[model samples]
Target chain A: MTASGTPASTGPASVPHLDVDPFDMAFFADPYPTHQRLREAGPVVYLDRWNVYGVARYAEVHAVLNDPATFCSSRGVGLSDFKKETPWRPPSLILEADPPAHTRTRAVLSKVLSPTVMKQVRDRFAAAAEERVDALLDQRSFDAITDLAEAYPLSIFPDALGLKPEGREHLIPYASVVFNAFGPPNELRQQAIARSSPHQAYVAEQCQRDNLAPGGFGACIHAQADAGAITATEAPLLVRSLLSAGLDTTVNGIGAAVYCLARFPEQWQRLRDDLTLARNAFEEAVRFESPVQTFFRTTTREVELSGATIGEGEKVLMFLAAANRDPRRWDQPDSYDITRRTSGHVGFGSGIHMCVGQLVARLEGEVMLTALARRIARIEITGEPKRRFNNTLRGLDSLPVTITPA
Target chain B: MPAITFIHPDGKSEHVETSGGESVMQAATRHGLDGILAECGGNAMCATCHVYVDESWLARLPAVAGDEDALLDGTAAERLPNSRLSCQINITPELDGLVLKLPERQV
Candidate 1:
């Protein structure tokens, strides 16, 4: 069941077919069942409506992600291929580019976000997280998503990026459109783009060198431009990459962490028993919830995966969230265990183009969860959690939680 | 406890007291060192945790696996003859006092 070049079904037309419109509204609401059906269908499932082939099992999805050259991203990591159709926004300098371009942009970004540079902001982030936790706990009962997850990243991340604080409110709506647009011109995407239209300018404006506060990550990206690492034009786009990527992913991740801890009280008690589990808890929640669910990759050549030989330029939809929970790769795949070694999960993706801001995400998750665990004795979900609908990102819109103070 | 020496990009050496069953990347991060990006959290994905093992100790380590080798080709720094991803290198007592040079950058 590993990522073999052979398909479960022989020949291309005989490819295991599933009529699931992955971008449909209902599928986004609860993807797990569809995920299960897709995985069980075959290693490679053909979606007729979109005319895209999908790999849902861990082995096949992992293979698609790892073999980026064969399953390229340069064409566009979305349903809209860059060559044939216009992208909603400028393609990511990091996420959507390949090889030579990706190599340079990634180098500059990694250098800007290198662990050493990140450590400088740790104390500041930890302090903000601690303050947010204490303030939220005073309320005792609040919507975890809005009051905590959304509130925290918005407050700290923008300031850290050296963005002008006045228009920072736009990050979330803008993020929704950006992530949603990856699926298709679906209702969710079209609606989000219209809703976020006013605020989209704020995102691009925040990346301007003149708009950035001195000596922040944004400024560093500009500095790289000065150093000839990236062009002056690529600088702002790279900055856009950071804000669009770093913000919502962390928020959903934090949301998932809080949601998971509340649902799994024993795991919460484990965190209370040992604060050191904070980082691992966040990672497990990522594996369990998989905030960013799916990304499309294009075939560079006639590639044989599972048992079908997919032709060149064919889009391969990689179900990352499904892969993380694949039964073949993990034991008790659906269970959330803070202590489980979450290595090899495609939650942050794999290969050359893995999440560059993941260190920041982990730091944010660790600080916030640690501060909460140290003060909160128990996390009880006060009401049923409501699902947040997004084309690609999976998260809770509202998680009512009542925390008992330690 | 077996010891591992991590030669940082800035040439500051932090000889960590380590144990078996943890990655060298984990050893560095666990001790709060400046090297090793480990962006995918040691999923053998990002080559940001690239390190160059001293030739003497290179033979003691496990040979690079296919995925790890494929990723090594994309390291920001030139792929040295001794280059390997620290995440792929597990700690073992037999290789106590092992040393790995951190690259200037491992994007």
Candidate 2:
């Protein structure tokens, strides 16, 4: 055993075991059961075939996320250890590094993504959300995911990041692959890799300084590099961070919000009654059905968890969705309640590496939620919602709904 | 009111009255002390509020947690061993004479 009491073996028998396969259909259809099983199994449960330790309990997940020194991010946050294989394109400059290096790069990008600067594009985002929702309202029967959720972000985020219209098509598939790559190289990763090839060049081209719009965040990151705050090479990857995180997460978040509101009509009416509740509704949805399901971190040293020992260099997967539903942290954990205080949940993650683009996400949700509250008197699912398959993110492929006009 | 001194990047010191319950970042921002930006709103998500704790007060302050230390890795300014996010440092009677050196920039 190592100093902290974790077994030093790299073999299958050394790690604590778990029963759930994250990519399985049942877990995908409803992950809470698997979450409960993992949490009940142990604080750090190892999956034999996947060869990773999983942390499903709320407290353990929180601890792992906050203690990056013990559980580092440099080995690539994905399931395939970066040390063993090179990443397909390149690792996200922001998501792939630990501090000192991560700090300098994050600083440059944060300035470009500052709340004041993001405010500049808020109205355009709101208008785009309204236009898309209105187009669906005219039909009165549309897939909430394809028609509204995907349509809205696809319309706004890329343009805001300074990509041209033709390049917009590549946004979703590329981002899906990136997030999927964070998981084991299962059928999901294979499928995403196959579909994502066509858009790689367009995504890479948009990373160039000349290709970005003059005043957008992407160009601004390059400007910071020019000013000696960051290197020119770091600029594109930082822009890629925005592109990679911007689209899929928000789309799933918004989709989750719609699913919750429709599932609980009383909550939708509450939002309609007071527009301020729009923000609360969106945030609560994140707490209710976390979009980015799970992310991994490598233990830098032997660390003691609730009852298990996580060895040095061992991988730990934090189930954000499971943690969000953890009974230890929330009252009636399964119920979707907007009024409940949810700000502390790890939906956007916790600790230093928490989502930098959260404000951008909130702004997007607020705009869409407000527009729907204003235009639609009531909404209910007309058909069973279809789930979009991904190893790490839970999103809708289609949510057919009937919209009653306000 | 306890007076907290913030030594700016330019070597200027600004004193502000801080409430017992508020964090150092909250007090500085509330009093318009320049050079500190708590961008994540004190959630420890962003390292914008980084400051070097004065050596005199280091022994009195609680040790930084593993999570906070990990976050300190990504600050724009070079991190000294005494570095802490001002948001995590709450003011109290024991910390009345606390002093922090503000970094040159907040990303």
> Which regions of candidate 2 are displaced past 4 Å?
A1-16, B1-41, B44-91, B95-107
Candidate 2 C-alpha lDDT tens digits along A54-106? 88888989988888888889887878777777877788777888897887887
Which residue ranges in model 1 land beyond 4 Å of their true spot? A1-11, B1-85, B88-107
Report the error of model 2 at residue B46, Å.
8.7
Give the whole-model CA lDDT for all candidates, comma-separated.
Answer: 0.86, 0.82
Q: What lDDT is reached at residue A60 by model 2?
A: 89
The digit string of per-residue lDDT tens for model 1 on A1-406 reads 2386545544457678888988886887778899999999999989988889999999998888888889999999988889888777778999999998898998888777765665688899999999998798789999999999999998899888998868777888888888988887878888887787677788888889999988899999999999999999999999999888889999999999998898889999999999978988998999999999999999988878876788888888999999999999888998999987676688888878888888789889989999999999988888988888888899988999888999
User: Clash pairs of candidate 1?
Assistant: A6-A306, A6-A307, A7-A306, A7-A307, A8-A307
What level of docking quality does candidate 2 show?
incorrect
Best by lDDT: 1
Error of 2 at B27 (Å): 15
Residue B58 Cα positional deviation in candidate 1, in Å, after optimal superposition: 6.2
